[model samples]
Target: MDYRQRRRIKVWGKAEYVEGDSALIERLRIPGYPAKVERAILFHVEALSENCSQHIPIRYSATEVEAMMAPLVARIEELEQKFVGE
Candidate 1:
């Protein structure tokens, strides 16, 4: 018999689009119309702890997801280019 622990991530709340999520958009320094960025949907990412089986929210914005992924996307592109000898 084997006992394994499973960890999961969950979105605690429904993603919502707010027309003026300026405070977050500004804080992230996302360049674009503040209102537009704010209008993007937002949600909470939660981590499930094995011991507690409770969802603990991780503070981050759904709007900034693109911004956060930019660097990784660039890196992947670079890697692909290198692999292709380009």
Candidate 2:
């Protein structure tokens, strides 16, 4: 089970090779941290599977959340202004 008690699948794989530094590796490297990815282990999947996402909650992007709250925020501001004026 996952953190949210959602069922998940396990996988079996083998380490294929150690990946060397490249453009993709450099892009993955985080700044200001002394630790760097000297090499990465590539995996060869023997078998893989996943369970249904029926238990997972829906997620929203920043723009979507802002758009959803805009009307409520405008109404709140309008009320605040009316009370201040009185």
What TM-score, over all chains together, does every model reach?
0.31, 0.41
Name the lDDT value of residue 5 in candidate 1.
Answer: 29
* Candidate 1 structure quality by residue, lDDT tens digits, 1-86: 11122334333556766566677656756566444443456675554333333443344466677889999999999999999995
Residue-wise C-alpha lDDT for candidate 2, range 1-86, written one tens digit per residue: 56345667878999855567576577767887788677666678899778787966666678988999999999999999999999
lDDT by candidate, in order shown: 0.58, 0.77
Model 2 error, position 2 (Å)? 16
Q: After superposing candidate 2 on the true structure, give the runs of residues whose Cα lies further than 4 Å from its correct spot.
A: 1-52
Q: lDDT, candidate 1, residue 77?
A: 96
Best by lDDT: 2
Candidate 1 regions off by >4 Å? 1-54
As a whole number from 0 to 100, the lDDT of residue 44 in candidate 2 is 81
